[model samples]
Each structure stands twice: as C-alpha cells, then as structure tokens.
Target: MKEELIAYIKSELIGDDTMEMNSEDDLLTSGLIDSLAIMRFIGHIEATHEIKVAPQDMVIENFINVDAIADYIQRTKNS
Candidate 1:
C-alpha cells in the first residue's frame, strides 16, 4: 500500500516520474503538493483506502510525507 501510494503520488499527482522521493520526504514544504493537490489527494486517499478523512484530520502532520500519510491511514483504519 505504501509503495502504491507513492507511485500514484509521483506519477499521477506530482506528474514527475523522475522525481526521487523518500518515505520521509516532505511533500507539502517541498512543494510537491499544493492546496488544490492536497484536496484532490484527500479524495484519492479516502477512495483508495476506504477510510474517512474528517475535516479536522486534514493537517500537515498527517500528510507531510509518505510515511506520515501511511501512518495516518493505519491509525484512521484502526479508529
């Protein structure tokens, strides 16, 4: 799931196949995703993961990096 999420983010959202990013790379601060992109990704994440992302769950800490997003998904799934 982590790998697939990263691939989707890189190929679809970021649209840069050559862009190398680590699991801990900062997507927001690094300008990999903006407000509009994050909104779109919220939809993608919810749909793809079958998880609900509440309005309050939308935060930089949750979506900062692939690892963070994956962790958020796991936590949300458990909740």
Candidate 2:
C-alpha cells in the first residue's frame, strides 16, 4: 500500500523524481506536495482507498510521507 501511494503521488500528483523518495521523507516540507496538491491527493486517497477522509482528519502528521499516508488509510479502513 505504501508503494502504491508513492506511485500514485509520483505519477498523478508530483510527476517527478520524488517518486524515489524514502518512506520517511517529508513530502510537504520537501516541496513534493504543495498546498493545492494536498487537496487533490486527499481526494485521490479517498477514492482509491474507498474511505472517507473527514475535514478533521486533514492533519499534516497523517500525511507527512507515503508510510504515514498508507498507515492512515489502513487505520481508517479498519475503523
């Protein structure tokens, strides 16, 4: 799932070499995900994972990196 999230972020969002980033890399601070792109990426995550990401869940800590995003999705799905 982490790999899939990374692939989606790379191919659909950033479309750059950031796809090769480590799991712990800071995507937002590293300029990989800008302000506007974050919304689109959330939509992508919701659609792909078939889970709702509520407005209250839009915290930077949950989306700091691919591993975090993947874990967020897994937890949300389990809930």
Candidate 3:
C-alpha cells in the first residue's frame, strides 16, 4: 500500500516519474503536494482500496505521509 501510494503520488499526482519519496516523507509540509492533490489522492485511495474516507478523517495526521495514510486505511478497515 505504501509503495502503491507513493507510486500514484509520483506518477499520477506529481507527474514526476523520477521523483523520490519515502513512506515517512512529510508530503504536506514539504510542499510535495497541495490541497487539490490531496483531494485527488483521497479519491484514488477510495477507488483503489474500496473504503470511504469520512470528512473528519481528512486531517493532517491521517495524511501526513504514505505511512500515515496506510495506517489510517488499516484502521478504517479494521473498524
């Protein structure tokens, strides 16, 4: 999931195939992605993972990075 998220962010969102990103990278704070990109990313996550991300779940902590997003998905699935 982390790899897929990173790949999607790079190849699809950022449109930079060569961009390097890690699971722990601060995507939001580092300016790697903006609000619009995050919305698109949430759409990607919902369509790909078959989960609904509630409005309240769209917080910074849940989307700080790839790992955080992965964790949020896992928790949502478990619940």
Candidate 4:
C-alpha cells in the first residue's frame, strides 16, 4: 500500500515518476503536497481500496506520510 501510494503520488499527483520519497517523509508539512493534492489522493485511496473515507477521518495524523496513510487504510479495512 505504501509503495502504491508513493507511486501514485509521484506519477499522478506530482507528474514526476522518478521522484524519490520515503514512507516517513512529511508530505504535508514539507510542502511536498498541498491541500488539493491531498483531496485527490484521498479520492484515489477510496477508489483503489474501496473504502469510504469519512470527513472526520481526513485528519493530518492519518495522512502525514505514506506510512500513516497505509496504516489508516488497514485500520479502515479491518473495521
């Protein structure tokens, strides 16, 4: 899930397939991605994982980085 998120962010969101990113990287605070990008990313996650992301679930803690997003997806799925 982490790899897929990274790949999607690099290829689709940033339009730079070769860009390098780590699971622990600060995607929000580091200016790697902005608010609009985050929304699109959430849409991608919802569609790809088939899990509905409630508005309340769209928190910074769940989207700080790839690792957090992956964990969020897992938790949402298990629930």
**Highest TM-score: which candidate?**
3
| Candidate 4 structure, TM-score to reference | 0.95
Tell me the lDDT of model 1 at 66: 90
Q: Report each candidate's C-alpha RMSD, comma-separated, in the order given.
A: 0.9, 1.5, 0.7, 0.7
Q: Taking the tens digit of each residue's C-alpha lDDT, what string does model 4 give over 1-79?
A: 7888999999988899987789999898888788898889889999999999999998899999899999999999999
lDDT of 1: 0.88
TM-score against native, each model: 0.93, 0.89, 0.96, 0.95
Error of 4 at 20 (Å): 1.2
Residue 54 accuracy (lDDT) in model 2: 93
**Best first by TM-score, ranked:** 3, 4, 1, 2
Report every candidate's CA lDDT. Answer: 0.88, 0.84, 0.91, 0.91
- Using TM-score as the yardstick, the better of models 1 and 2 is 1
The superposed Cα distance between candidate 1 and the true structure at residue 30, in angstroms, equals 1.2
Q: Poorest 10 consecutive residues of model 2 by lDDT?
A: 13-22
Question: On residues 1-79, what C-alpha lDDT tens digit does candidate 3 reach at each position?
Answer: 8888898999988999897788999988888788898899999999999999999998999999889999999999899
What would the per-residue lDDT of candidate 2 be over residues 4-78, giving only the tens digit for each residue? 777777887888745376788898888877889999988888888899999998898898888888889989999
lDDT of 2: 0.84
The 10-residue segment with the lowest total lDDT in model 4: 26-35
Tens digits of per-residue lDDT for model 1 on 1-79? Answer: 7888888889889899887878888888877787898888889999999999999988879988999999999999998
Q: Give the TM-score of candidate 1.
A: 0.93
